[model samples]
Target: MEITEVSITPLEESRLKAYVNITFDEVFVIHGLRVIQGNHGMFVSMPARRLPDGSYKDIAHPITNAFRLKIQQVVLDAYKEIISENTLEKTEDQKQENVAVQ
Candidate 1:
């Protein structure tokens, strides 16, 4: 299965960075994945649901470690690209402000 598309929406809260939606083979879609900042760094959290027992369970996940890693890598790559774009924009804005002040 090929990941046809990925959409990331950035957030501004602690730990949680963004929400992710991925499409597979241009036919299947999965939502509610999260990009989180942990102690080590950023990682992807799979979509999940709250069970009746008050615990959360993954709504969908890869069965194999390899597949899980592949998903994480793809999502993380997209997330990094977005973050870099935002950072570049912010840097440019700062430069413009400095020029204005000068």
Candidate 2:
């Protein structure tokens, strides 16, 4: 299976930086993955649910480390692209405001 598409929704005001959804082979889609800002750095988190014991369990995850890394890389790459685009947009808006003021 191959990752056909990745969607990112950015968030502010927390360590939870964004939410992600990835599509595989243009058919299968996984939702609710998270991009978290951790002490080490940004990382992809698998979708999980709170169990009865108040612990979290992954609802869906890759079985192999290779596949897991692939998913993480793809998700993180998409997230970074979104962030850069947003930053560029904000900078452009600032430049426009400066021009208007002048």
Superposed on all Cα atoms, model 1 deviates from the true structure by an RMSD in Å of 1.2
User: Could you tell me every candidate's TM-score relative to the true structure?
Assistant: 0.91, 0.97
TM accuracy, model 2: 0.97
Tens-place lDDT digits, model 1, residues 1-102 = 888999999998999999999999999999999999999998999999898999999999999999888889999999999999999999999999999999
lDDT of each: 0.95, 0.96
Clashing pairs in 1: none
lDDT for model 2, please. 0.96
Candidate that would win on TM-score: 2
**Model 2, which residues run further than 4 Å from truth?**
none
